[model samples]
Target chain A: MMPLWVGPVARYMATGLVTTLALAVVSIAVSVVLGTLLGALLVLPSRAVRLAVRCYVEIWRGLPIIVTLFFIFFVLPVIGLRFDTFVAAAIGLCLWGSANVAEVVRGAVQSVPRGQADAAAALGFPWRQRMRYVVFPQAVRRAVPPLVGLVVNLTQQTSLATVIGVLDLLQASQRSIERLTLSSGATHAVPILGAVLVVYFVICLPLTSLSRRLERSLQRA
Target chain B: MTAVDFEPGFVFSHLGPLGQGLARTLAISAVGTAGALAVGGLLGAASALRIPVVRQVIGAYVEVFRNTPLLVQIFFLYFALPEAGVKLSAFTVGWLSLVLWGGAYNAENFRAGFEAVDPKYVEACRALGFSELASFRRVVLPLGTRTALPSVTNTLISVFKNSSFMIAIGYPELTDTAVDIVSVTFRAFEVFIAIGVVYLGLVWIFSLGAGLIERRFAIPGGH
Candidate 1:
């Protein structure tokens, strides 16, 4: 793929690609866990917890990821907290991902048939046990496709981390473009950004298609 | 490009500038979503009217937008297309890009709406000697509009959210302006929270407005 484009630029992109994946993978893990907790918190019987969770999800979803990234990158250091670029990128992506996941979780939980929960309760299954043992497993299955789609989105959102000087794929291309086209007249933007696009496409397309496949499979089931 | 250390008083002093960006954010999203709904409805209806050429053209356009990332689409409009001789402000590029991208998604919503219109109604109109346009206007459009609302609300919310990307190309929108302030002050948490609160407040207002409209329009005992 690098040879198909430009060797040196492609090589730089390949190296920078690691930073992107790190942001994506760590961000995804943290988000899913946070989302699950937030989702569960919202569905709790306590009105206060539910209200708080609902508010958190709503506020996060409405806000833009770019805005959040800026906040993460620029804000914390002023409050006597400083995280490096990678950590900031991870935290920013995590915060954004969690909100989307919470929505997916909420939808999936609702999608579970009413009878299953009722039946589980009738059989003397405790509420906590029922959710943990019965309802959640099924909801997770239903949630997978949308969750995948959310991840695909999250993957793209990670590109915004480049704005914080993270040196992810997009930032790498920006750097090379500055060097090649603008600065030295030796490097190029089209190939670099174009190459970044394909790398992104390669990373994202499979997950998106997989999400579709899962949806179809579930439909068939 | 100036990065600074975070401090307490920074966000308070800059809060005034940030509030102005929120107005721009709302304006861009509202105008863009409205434009998208209009274009999407027309395209969706045209595609479904059994006009082969029109259907093909609309279908292809939708496919192109739906498959690509919105950032690339925005970049193409803001940077690339201008080189092709059409110059537009960054804001115009932002608005038009969302309108195009969101409209494609909206078209699908409207297409589903069109399909959901009971064919029996169309047939009944035919029996009553209603013209095709009359039947569509009186019967089809109303039902389609109602059926399309909930789905389009999703797109509407998304249009608002994605409009933030307009900041990337220097659209002077709320998010972009916030980034500038945060970059200068390095007060990340406060500015982020401030932006989040503004967004939450707006979305709440939107949801409240949506509820009012839904209630006003809801059919008694209607799904």
Candidate 2:
């Protein structure tokens, strides 16, 4: 008997896996960059900018990822901002991911002792110089492990794209199961879903372990 | 596709069905939170006690659940388990997945809480002639629960938010109801905005309750 996943089914699932990875990479990249900027802005002296960024973070973080995905995928088009399924999913994921990343960034930056900034000021360093040379270097070190943890989270969250009709790994698996069941008159959901779970476990476990390890090492340092 | 029209009142017209959906979401979230706390509390206590085989099993369980997406787990229980001669309704799958996922994270939270219990307290119990189990019950449980409260609240709120995923399996929760309304009314913007506000309001309530409980049980001058 030919193996079920060895032929076209395998190829199809591989394509889906690539899409999942692409979505994750795009979301992570955009969120991390955008979130860092937002996080920096959150702590600025300007009350208006801080309030605006805080509201954005709180509102986005407060909602579920699926709701956000639906809003971007379905609601946005109605407002004359149409995107392809992939782009819509990516945008939704990025918005949520960045909100969370911003919190992590804000927390890390805030955790730096006030004395450090005060001392920098005493040295005649400007706000930009103090942040660049003193505060941010320390904040980046504190942020690395959580940021890594967020990568794992955002990667797993890419699964949400399947709900928005993206042909991600989970979606691919579901389609494969449907086709296989129809063709063979037997359900393959057991093995197929099992494979999807295992695939996610494999991809995420190392990152989870790495994040934990980084956290432990950082705590000691 | 037409003009930018905002109808904030659209959702109120469908409040009857939406209210029922909110009830279902709350029901599942409440039950899931309780069930997860029970499971996590037991596993956490067991691991803390260092039962060799059980600790290893719990470790593996936590890693597996925590590392994978909850959506995939829902699909697994919903689709794959039926092939194994076990069947569950969509609602069962919904809350069960939450229990499993939240339980795993809560296990870690509770374990950390238990570990954070001051060793000095355990010593005090022993000095008073308390047995290991007695000391654990009399001293560890209460203090550890206090420490665990914040993270537990976080997990519970997650359970509440995650109930939204049940929409995929057709459980007719809040998100599902909104989606249904949008499909029929073609009022995607209004429906989603209203739903988003409802969710934000619920989450706010959750955190507010958590704060109250935390303050109520806080040890005097304790961090």
Q: What DockQ would you assign to candidate 1?
A: 0.32
What CA root-mean-square deviation does each model show from the true structure? Answer: 4.2, 1.7
Lowest lDDT 10-mer window, candidate 2 chain B?
A: B1-10
Top lDDT model: 2
Judge candidate 2 at residue A176 and give its lDDT: 93
Please, what are the lDDT tens digits per residue for candidate 1 over residues A1-221?
A: 33433667667877788988888889898999999889877777899988888877876777777777777667566655879988987887787789889888988987889899899999999999989888899999999999998888787777777667788877776666665656455444444555566667667767867987998799789
- Label model 1 with its docking quality class: acceptable
Question: What does candidate 2's lDDT look like per residue over A1-221, in tens digits?
Answer: 97855488778998999999999999999999999999999889999999999999988899999999988878777877769999999999989999999999999999999999999999999999999999999999899999998999999999989888999999999999998888887778998889889999999999999998998898798
Candidate 1, residue B41: the lDDT equals 91
Against the reference, the lDDT scores of all candidates come to 0.78, 0.91
Q: Give one digit per residue, the lDDT tens place, for model 2 in B1-223.
A: 4778888887789999999999999989988999999999999998887788999999999999999999999999999999999899998998899999999999998998888899999999999999989999888889998999898888889899999999878899999998888888888888888889999999999999999999999867887
Worst-scoring 10-residue span by lDDT in model 1 chain B: B1-10
DockQ of each two-chain model? 0.32, 0.79
